[model samples]
Target: MNKKAIVTAGLAAALSIGAISTAQAASKEKCYGIAKAGQNDCANISGTHSCAGQSKTDNALDDWKAVKAGTCEEMGGYSKAQAKELLKKQKEMKG
Candidate 1:
């Protein structure tokens, strides 16, 4: 293939990947206190780890998983606001 054609193809591929990632992110919601161990969607709030599948405990309020919006509560997950409340309660109990 010509050099120009190859570069065009590469650019198209990159744009396609970016669009797919955006769509996936749009469809997901950050749900807290529901992910199982090693099943989180991304890093914890404390910066203890990066990437998915790294949660140390199930239902850790600081950790979150991606779930479809409007379905997290059904799945026993907390919204960001609710999660903050839960975290506060936990800290109170511990202190």
Candidate 2:
């Protein structure tokens, strides 16, 4: 193949791979309190950190990792709403 054709093919393959991964991510849900230390998928709910893999505690209420949709509760992880409510309750009790 010509150089131009090879480059075009490579670009198309990369884009398709990205699209596939995006679709897979769409099927995932953030499961709170499931991440081990430094295993979180993104920033924690408490904002103590602002990046993935920065969680300092295992299974923190504010930390989350992406798990397959519909399997969070089965895995003993809370939804965002549940985590938020629990955090609020914790704060209230502390006061």
Candidate 3:
């Protein structure tokens, strides 16, 4: 292919990748209180674990799993703000 065509193709590929990334990010949200035991997406806020599928407890406020945005509540998952509040309440109860 000609130099101009090659450059255009490269730019198009880069743009397509960027668009896909943005769309995925926009659609996913960090949801807490929905991950099953040993099924969390990543680290927990309490520093107990740092990998997916390592949680010992289900529906932990410190554990978060990614779910489709705008569907967390419907799925019985808590938003970040709500999770924080729940954590605070738990701490108060413990104290």
Candidate 4:
């Protein structure tokens, strides 16, 4: 193939890789589930008490987004794996 065609193909491959990486990152954020949150309340799910001073609704997925990285192993809420993801999602959403 001509240099121009080769360059185009390379660019397309790069773009595809970038898109896949982004999606994978997004999926990782969901690793933390209700099991980690302690309770299904999302807010209470965090063990760090980071959400202590915040309102109840802030932890909602549609609210302020993300959560503080409390105890990833869960204390008052969530399971180990679930809490881990919740913390990640909480941080991502917060930003």
**Candidate 4 lDDT, tens digit per residue, 20-49?**
977765554221332322233223444434
Put the candidates in lDDT order, highest first. Answer: 2, 3, 1, 4
User: Which wins on lDDT, candidate 3 or candidate 4?
Assistant: 3
The whole-model lDDT of each prediction reads: 0.88, 0.95, 0.91, 0.46
Q: Write the per-residue lDDT of candidate 2 for residues 1-95, one digit (tens) a residue.
A: 99999999999999999999999999999999999999999998888999999999899999999999999999999999999999999999999
Best prediction by TM-score: 2
Error of 1 at 51 (Å): 4.5
TM-scores of the models, in the order given? 0.83, 0.88, 0.79, 0.34
Candidate 4 segments exceeding 4 Å error: 30-95
Assess the local accuracy of residue 55 in candidate 4 as a C-alpha lDDT between 0 and 100: 32
Q: Which stretches of candidate 1 lie over 4 Å from their true place?
A: 46-51
Once fitted onto the true fold, the runs of candidate 2 whose alpha carbons sit more than 4 angstroms away are none
- With candidate 1 superimposed using the best TM-score fit, by how many Å does residue 78's alpha carbon deviate from the native? 0.7
Deviation from native of the Cα of residue 14 in model 3, angstroms: 3.3
lDDT of 1 at 5: 100
Shift in Å, residue 45, candidate 1: 2.9
Ranking by TM-score: 2, 1, 3, 4
